[model samples]
Target: MRYLAAYGGENNVKAGMLHYFMYPSNDISVMPKEFLEERNATNHSNIGEKTLKKSIDIYWELYKVKGRLQ
Candidate 1:
């Protein structure tokens, strides 16, 4: 709590920067890019397309911002 306060006083909760302390699955292997691509192509489409697209957009934006900062 003290350390987090040093960062920004905890008044602001930034998305994509701070994640839950514990995640349901810590294994990244379960959601590989190829697997997501294949699932997205399938008829049923395991995950919702809109949700996946939004996540991808967020990643791209973060990447761009990081590159610019450096």
Candidate 2:
């Protein structure tokens, strides 16, 4: 398991978000060009798309509210 405590915002979250999604456990093989561009205004990673959608889906399922709220 891994934990991250980072500020929210485009700039503040980019590097951390990238690292999270690219972590070996996540198995993310590609990343959206726009995302990498926004990360550093350059697309040197040469990764592809569907990364955002995949990451969001994983996040939603991982952090989804389960059972009844207390």
Candidate 3:
């Protein structure tokens, strides 16, 4: 919990940064330029409540899958 404080603001709750973290290292060279442009264009604050609900569903699925891995 203390570590999450470093990211600040809603970042601790935001899935966008988590998607980046789970992506293969920060090797922009490996990612397509168009994908990078799209990532940069994302406006998290403007995201609708439905998206957040979907994210929660994804989080639960990921949690279940991760538990199965062990």
Candidate 4:
């Protein structure tokens, strides 16, 4: 999302390209076996939750700034 904002929001061509590159369809198929195993093991871990919360907080901050500008 930050990348999208940096490239001029979701509607921009560069943002679309960035999204495609960042989230390729073959991501899981190409991942290392050990990394996949570790991710599966930590599927329900607190780290994932914390990371998600942090991302939301950042987006919220950006949203507030946008609102103020408007």
lDDT ranking, high to low:
3, 4, 2, 1
lDDT of 1 by residue, 1-70 (tens): 2223333432222321232111222232234566656653223333555665565456545544334654
Ranking by TM-score: 1, 3, 4, 2
Q: Rate the local accuracy (lDDT) of all candidates.
A: 0.37, 0.43, 0.45, 0.44
Query: What is candidate 4's local distance difference test score?
Result: 0.44
For candidate 3, lDDT tens digit of each residue in 1-70?
2212433444443443444434424342234567766665333334555675577456645543334664
Name model 1 segments beyond 4 Å from true: 1-45, 65-70
Instruction: Summarize candidate 2's per-residue lDDT along 1-70 as a digit string, tens digits.
Output: 1222333443334445565444522233234556555553322232533675466457645754444258
The Cα RMSD of model 3 versus the native structure comes to 9.2
Ranked by lDDT, the better of candidates 1 and 3 is 3
lDDT score for candidate 1 against the true structure: 0.37
On the 0 to 100 scale, the lDDT of residue 34 in model 2 is: 60
At residue 65, give the lDDT of candidate 1. Answer: 31
- Minimal lDDT window, size 10, model 3: 1-10
Residues 19-66, model 4: lDDT tens digits: 433444334223456665665422222345456555545655665334
Which ten contiguous residues of candidate 1 have the minimum total lDDT? 15-24
